[model samples]
Target: MQETLEFPDLLRLIDERSTAFLAAVAAAPSLDAMVPTCPEWTLFDLVEHMGTGRRSWAATVAAGPRATAKVEAEGAPAVPREREALLAWMAESTRQLLDALREAGPDRGCWVWWGDSQSPATCGAVARHQLQQFAVHTYDAQLTAGDPRPLTEDVALDGVEEFLVTCCATTSAWPHEPATIDYHATEGRSWRVRLSADGARIARLPATTTDEADATGTGTAGELVLAFYDRIPLDSLELAGDRLVFDRIVAWEPE
Candidate 1:
């Protein structure tokens, strides 16, 4: 895996991108317009989800495992119908989350549902996770507004690594038998992901010539990251070798 971003850097990214996301929400022509990428949600629903999710994560950071139940409780805060009110509420909730994360510091223990238990439950992990969440949702918001912008190469590359380790490797939900596929980012990073009946494993490959594996996907880091999340289709990527292998891997849903 690539080296993770420092906690402070991740926090900065969350702040920057989330501000942009809220701006998109503010500028949306109609809150009722459907988000094409997230077909089930309207713009209003998306903003509400993002805001409430921040609050839940903030609670988790502040209270550790004990906050899980409270975060999951029914009747989470509702998004205001008025756009200005919704924006203000989102801003306040985001600040609460940022404050909680900052007070906890990078090394402070917190609760994380994904990845190995042995992995440190630090505020740094929370920041990193939230950065990706904010970045992807920002794209969703922009795409909804017909102004899609790619994430920066650095954030996209790190997001690819985080998705593999935190989401893929830690789950037993991949139903496929043993297989390997390589993902090559145009920014010049590549990863080999191995999926088996047991689970998944991922490794960063050296930037040297090597034989192609069962499948290979070449794209910008941002494209790869979005495709990995299924926010974008696999065909958005340039694929070589077995398309089926790549499709199966991407199709796997975490349990």
Candidate 2:
């Protein structure tokens, strides 16, 4: 992994991924189609979620940090007629966000809710969170459309790394009763996470889950993120050790 990566690069990567995800979603046939990972959410629901999510993030970054600002974008209307328009809107909104982040600079100071993460430059939480959301949502769209692609290990591992550190390691998002979690990616690639009770942690691990774990989960890193995010079912993972640990890890919020 590169040392001290600037947030602009992360934003660029996220922007590329956002495009990739939208393309996959466009590959889908119908909004009513069922997503394999998120059985309850239809393709329509996933598309709407992505659009609204982009709007919310764009608003958040623009607001310059606060205690959860209310997003102005109207909630998804009751009747969605043209899914294609919504998908295009998602793409353009994400592109605009990338532009904003580039202008925002990693070192640029700003207000934030977290104690140590008050700076937009250093506060890397929302970036990683949204990336994972796009990844899983893309996967969901792919599965729902009955067309799946091999998730890039480099990309998936990046997501796995960020999720472990930002979400599992710290309860900054939850702020109370925060338990940490660690993700270990097998397959002998570079990926793992160790989230503990003290401000949660993330780092590359030499091994995936094993008998030594409180619980173990085995799957592709992409699958792991999807499973963790509630987009995928529990049975999808091959588990061992303490299932509770794995379950607890997945139960955390997206923030």
Candidate 3:
């Protein structure tokens, strides 16, 4: 399994990306502008989700390791209707989350959705996943505001692994024909993912490989990660083999 990012580094990203997300929303032409990636959501809805999500996760982390409460029951405040108030809520929610994460530190046991995966149920796990949450939603915010930017290489690469570990490669059965797909990032990283009725497995490929796959996707790290998150089209990548396998794997979400 790939290592989780250093606790401090993950926290730093959470802060920076959340700030970027808020900045994007604050500068948006209109809060009502629809997000292209999330066809059903407006910029306002996106910000509200970000704010309340942070709030809910904060409560979960604060509950410590043995806690079993669902995140949705954390009593996060509803979004304020006013523009300034909504932005303020988002900012405060972020601050509280950061505070909670710092207090818990990296190894402290905490509630996390991916406890069964290689990632432990700890404050660090929450921080890692939340960083991706901010990173991806920031793109949503930027896209809504018409100022989208590519994710940093470090964030993008980490996100790709996180998505696979947390969202894919799960105990849940695949319930589809067996297939293998390869993802190659221009920066030299690669992952070979296998899916079967049993479940899914992912292996990090060597710097060079001769083995073939049912489907292959090649792109820069940013593009590959964004495509995995469905933030961008898979067609944007150089693809080979069964495109349907690529589509199914990308669309699969952990229950």
Candidate 4:
């Protein structure tokens, strides 16, 4: 089973990363400036998305396990237009999420969208998934501000698994032939992903596992995570074997 960070640890990172994102927003050239990564969004839009989404998730957690959570899209309050008010709203959004998580605790069951396939119905899973979103969007904010920073090694490592479970693994059938891809991190961690009509299956490779995969990608943990999120191109990693299959897997998205 994939082990996620402890609940408290996840909370800590979420706070740190969200704070960083807010700081980037504060220092950004303009709220109207376009985000290169998310072309459809401005800095204001980005903040609204994160803040509002966090509030929605907070409601989900507070509702307890298996409860139908309220959604912001369903007549929620509008986001503030002013920078200072928006920042304060975002901060409060984070605080609410943190407060909800703390009260529910990790083991408490929660209604998560991933179902039982990618994650368990627990608040801990919500925290981990939220961390990934914060990490990625934080990078988006930084990149938009022309001040991108590297992800912490630990977050990047966990992010790979998180991305696979939450985004890559799906019940949809793969149209292409079966293949295996190996990811080797400079830090000695490695994972092997088998792609087939059965969908994508990922497992941490045993030390004895052979290196002869149909496609192999090598890079630092951070680079791999960034590439998975499309913050960086696949070519940034050293690759070998079937480029076509690798590209196909990289481009795969759930319906």
Q: Of the candidates shown, which would achieve the greatest lDDT relative to the real structure?
A: 4
Q: What's the TM for model 2? A: 0.72
lDDT of each: 0.81, 0.59, 0.83, 0.85
Best by TM-score: 4
Q: Order of all candidates by lDDT, from best down to worst?
A: 4, 3, 1, 2
TM-score of 1: 0.90
TM-score of 4: 0.92
lDDT of 4 at 192: 79
**Residue 28 Cα positional deviation in candidate 3, in Å, after optimal superposition:** 0.5
TM-score, cand. 3 vs. native: 0.90
Residue-wise lDDT of candidate 2 within 1-255, one digit each (tens)?
433334665676677778877777777877777777765878777777777667666655655545254344445343344877767677766875666556665544433334332112333556655666677677777777777775667567666665555444443444334332334556554433444444444555454434243455677877676666766676777776656655555555535
Q: Please write out the lDDT profile of model 1 over residues 1-255, one tens digit for every residue.
A: 447788788888889998999888877789998998887999999988998889888877888645544354235566689989999989977898899899888887776877462235677877887889999999999988888889987789889887777776754745776788888999888888877765677888898857668888889999988998788888999988888887777566757
- Give TM-scores for every candidate, taking all chains together and pairing residue i with residue i: 0.90, 0.72, 0.90, 0.92
Ranking by TM-score: 4, 3, 1, 2
Model 3, 1-255: lDDT tens digits are 565478899999999998899899988999999999998999988988888788888777877876886365255566898888998999999998999899999889887766556566778878888999999999999999999999988888888877776767666677688888888888778888878766787788886689899999999888987887888888999999988887687677755
| lDDT accuracy of residue 52 in candidate 2 | 69
lDDT of 4: 0.85
- Residue pairs in steric clash, candidate 1? none
